[model samples]
Target: MEQAEIGLIGLGVMGSNLALNIAEKGNKIAVFNRTQEATKKFYAEAGALQSQIIPCETLEEFVAAIRPPRPIIIMIKAGDPVDQQMELLKPYLSAGDIMIDAGNANFRDTMRRFDSLKDSPLTFIGMGVSGGEEGARHGPSIMVGGTEESWKRVEKVLTSISAKFNGDPCVAWLGNDGAGHFVKTIHNGIEYADMQMIAEIYGILRDGLKLSAPEISKVFGNWNTGRLNSYLIEITEKVLAAADPITGQPMVDVILDAAGQKGTGKWSVIEAQNLGVAATGIEAAVAGRILSSQKAERVEAEKILGLPDTLAFPAVDGVAFLKDLESALLAAKIGAYAQGFAVMAAASKEYGWHLPMPTIAKIWRAGCIIRSQFLDEITSAFTKDPDVANLIVTPAFAALVKETDGALRRVVSTAALAGLPVPALASALSYFDSYRRSRGTANLIQAQRDFFGAHGFDRVDGVDKHHGPWGSGAAIY
Candidate 1:
């Protein structure tokens, strides 16, 4: 029997689709699943395509069926399952075999796995595949972190199966070991912040402006035609317009208000804190999700304490106000991306990835949850200046902030006066404003810290740190 070019484990929704995608790319694929039934079902369903799929009932058979110096792709759940698969497949494989993980595992764990295989002849690759189930069967943006030799063995397959932006493949080798997954994590962090800002604007439309679901849906559809044209915005329009088949009510309205997370967003925020990066927009998004999860507590609190009264939403023409909301959302979106890229820059330095920011932006232009025209603009910015410390300082981006800053400030004010939560949007503006400041109020904070804990502060023109003395009767106070 001829050896299959590659092998894949797991036949779950994503895994199955990816296998088909690979086979369709004309490479013979050997496949196996822990459950024999899944293998049988997939083999039967493949029908006309079965000639390209080699089904194996055991790991030994799967390994033997693949070509020598085998490249195996694993798409199981992101935790212990990965380790278990590695152990199960190790004994059957020889030196120089490559193992590719396409799941959303934490980058730290990926690095640990990479280190564990350092002494062995085997190679490990932790890759990030974004875009949902449909994307897997067609094209998705691919981020690869692995050795040059390992990447060379499979680059053609990945590039062939990944999405293209203006005919350029969205798959690229970022660096060795956890760089791909690290970039993907921050991508999700920006996603969370982007989603929260959109939700805040939706809240302004739903309650403050008293617009109906369909009306709001139309507004979203309009936004998709301009700079905010993105997958999330396009979906928001559909979600708002959808009707429940049973109750005939708006689907979004009937759905639960609580948001559920799978931990990637939290991981991003934790890493930001660890690295001392000011990713305030991502931080607020993570916090907003946590707050949303406390549905019962929110209900009780609203009943216990009366809602505060504030100034009503402006009684301006709908078109004029929606334009402001658009500008507000655009500015916040820019801030979120700026902060996300800053985090990635820090990670690149700390990890020695030397990741190319322009390539990252190019890949994100399509086949990702956050795909947008703004990413194209970002690509242009990076192409012009690859080493910008912060995006707001770039010529193109600085001008953008100057144009939309007022709109953002206005929307934040309206949300505040209307007694609504706008954590992500507010955080974006505050972060931007804070970044532009030359002198801040931290001197007072430093003085207070010194007074209470004897912590030292640095003088602007002096070389040594300075300490402050407590005022008279400080103990009594």
Candidate 2:
């Protein structure tokens, strides 16, 4: 048999689908699973593609089945399992071979892994694959980070299997070491903010406006044809329209309110803070999930204290209010994405990756969960002004912010008065209000900090005095 062009380990959902995709694209692939039964099961299910797939039960067989200068992708649980798997496979790999980690890993871990293999001939690539299960079986947005030579070796195969937008492949060699993973983390962070803002608008429609699930579904379906046109909105329409067979209730109504997370959102916020970038929208989304998880506590608290005394929603023109909700969602989404990109920009500088902002935006136009027409606009903005201090300040985005901010302001204010929890949307509104202002209330904060802790503050005037004389028992500085 001819040696396979590529090899994959792990027979999990993502791994199996990705392997089938590679084989379907006419690239002969060797696949291995830690368990022999899994490898056998996957090959049996391959059907016509079985001829193109070589199933191996051992690491050595897997490695040997691939051609020289092999590129092996390890798709498995992240953290220590990844480290252990790499250590086990290192002895089998020859010089010039590449090991690619395609899991949702922390960039710090990715950087460490790349450094660990730096002295050896076996190079490492931290790759980020998005678009989920369907994407893995078809094509996903792929972000590659490694040596330029290593990227070249695998670029052809990767490009062939990546999603395309307007004939452009949704894949690129982002930078070295952890750049790909870092970008993916920010992608997910933006996703969290997007989802939360959508849910908030849903809450307003369902609880505030007293709309039925089907009615709300129509609203989302309509929005999917407009500026908010995206996968999430399209799915929200379908999900809301779905009915539970057992309970005969709306599918969403029958489901639990709590949402689960796997730490990426939190990591995005942490890294943003570390980089001194304000990611308040992502922060609010993570907090929303945390608060939702405390269902029992919320129930008990509601029983004890009861709902807020204010009206759920003050009477308003239903037609006009619906439009406001739509515009508000768009405005808030802009803030979230701007913050996400800002985080990536800061990371690119800190890590010296020089990550291509325009390319990142271009690829995300398809395949990824956050894929939207809006990202294409982002690509244009970055392509024009790659070094713009903030995405919000760009000419195109500035006009959008001006156009939609009023709606966001109204919706957020209405939600507040109605005692509705719209934390993510509210955060976006505040972020915009703070960002656009020439001066802010932080001057008082600076004085307070200097008074309490003697932290120096910069003078707006030419005066060199850094501290104020607190007219009390405090010493003057």
Candidate 3:
């Protein structure tokens, strides 16, 4: 039999589906699971695609089935498991063989793995695969980080199996080392903020306006047809509309309020802080999840502290306010996306990735959870000025902010007065406010720092004075 063009080392949901996708795309793939039973079952279930799948029972068999200078995808659990799997596979791989780590790994780990294999004949790739199981079986956005020569060896197959936006493949060789994984981390960070903002809007509708699930579903459906046309918003509509078969209640209504998270969101916040970038919206979203997990504590606290006195939503022009909510959502979304891109920009400089911002935006227009028409607009903005510092200052986005910021201000003010929790939205508003002003309250902070810690401060007048003379709790100057 002809040798398989590529090989895969895991048979979990993502791995199996990805193998099938490769087969469907006319690329013969050799697949092996840790268990022989899984490999056999996956091949048996492949049916028509089985002819393209070579299921191997041993690492030796799997490695021999692939062509020389092999590109093998290791779609196993991240961190320690990935390390262990790489060690196990290394014995079988010859010089020039590529091991692709397609998991949500911390980029620092990815960088170390790449550097560890630098002198070896084998090479490492840190690939970020987004869009979950369904996208894996069809196509997902693929971010590849490896040597340029190594990338060339696998680009065709990756492009063949990636999601397409306007007939363009949603995959790219971002840069060397951990660029792909870093971009993926920012993607998830933005996703957290996006979902939180949507949920905040839903909270206002359900709790403040006392709208039913069906009514809120209708609202989301309407938003999906407008500026907020995104996978998350589209799914939010469906999730609200769905009824649980057991209770015949709205699906979302029956589900627990607590949200669970893997580590990507936290990693994004940590990286942002390390980069000294203000990712307040993403930070608030992660905090929201952390606070959400403390359901028992929250329940007990609410019982003792009671709801805020001004808990009632103020009556207003329903139609006008609804419009305001829509505009507010758009504005908050801009803030979150801008912050995510800013984090990437900083990382690109710090790591010397020189990541293609326009390409990142382009790929995110489809396949990923955060896929949206808005990303197309972002793509356009970045395309015009690849190194524009921040996404919000782009001509198109600046105009958008100008048009929508008033509604955001109004919605935030209203939510505050009604004691509604809109941390992500409020953070976005504050981020925008803080970012735009040439002058800020930081001067007072500088003065306080100097007073307490004797830290020096810069003068606006370009004078030689660096210290604020303080004695007897007064400005001695």
Q: Estimate each model's TM-score.
A: 0.97, 0.98, 0.98
lDDT of each: 0.91, 0.93, 0.94
Where is model 3 more than 4 Å wrong at Cα?
472-477
TM-score of 3: 0.98
> Tens digits of per-residue lDDT for model 3 on 1-477?
899999999999999999999999999999999999999999999999998999999999999999988999999999999999999999999999999999999999999999999999999999999999988999999999999988998998999999999899999999999999999999999999999999999999998899999999999999899998999999999999999999999989899889999999999999999999999999999999999999999999999999899998999798898999999999999999999999999999999999999999988877898998789899999999999989999999999999999999999999999999999999989998999999999999998888877778999999998988687775533
Residue pairs in collision within model 3? none
Error of 1 at 259 (Å): 0.5
- Which of candidates 1 and 3 is the stronger one according to lDDT? 3
Tens-digit per-residue lDDT, 1-477, candidate 1: 889989999999999999998888888999999999999999899877899999999999999999978999999999899999999999999999999999988999899999999999898999999987977888998899999899999998888889888999988999999998998899899999999999999999998999889999999999999989999999999999999999998898898889988888999999988888999999999999999999999999999986767747666677878998999999999999999999899889999999999999999988888999888889999999999998889999999999989989988988898898899999999998899999999999988877776677898889675876577633232
Model 1 steric clash total:
0
Alpha-carbon shift of residue 329 in model 2 (angstroms):
0.5
Q: Model 2, which residues run further than 4 Å from truth?
A: 475-477
- Model 3, clash count? 0
Per-residue lDDT of 315-386 in model 2, one digit per residue for the tens? 889989889999999999999999999999999999999999999999898889999879989999999999
How far is 186's C-alpha from truth in model 3 (Å)?
A: 0.4
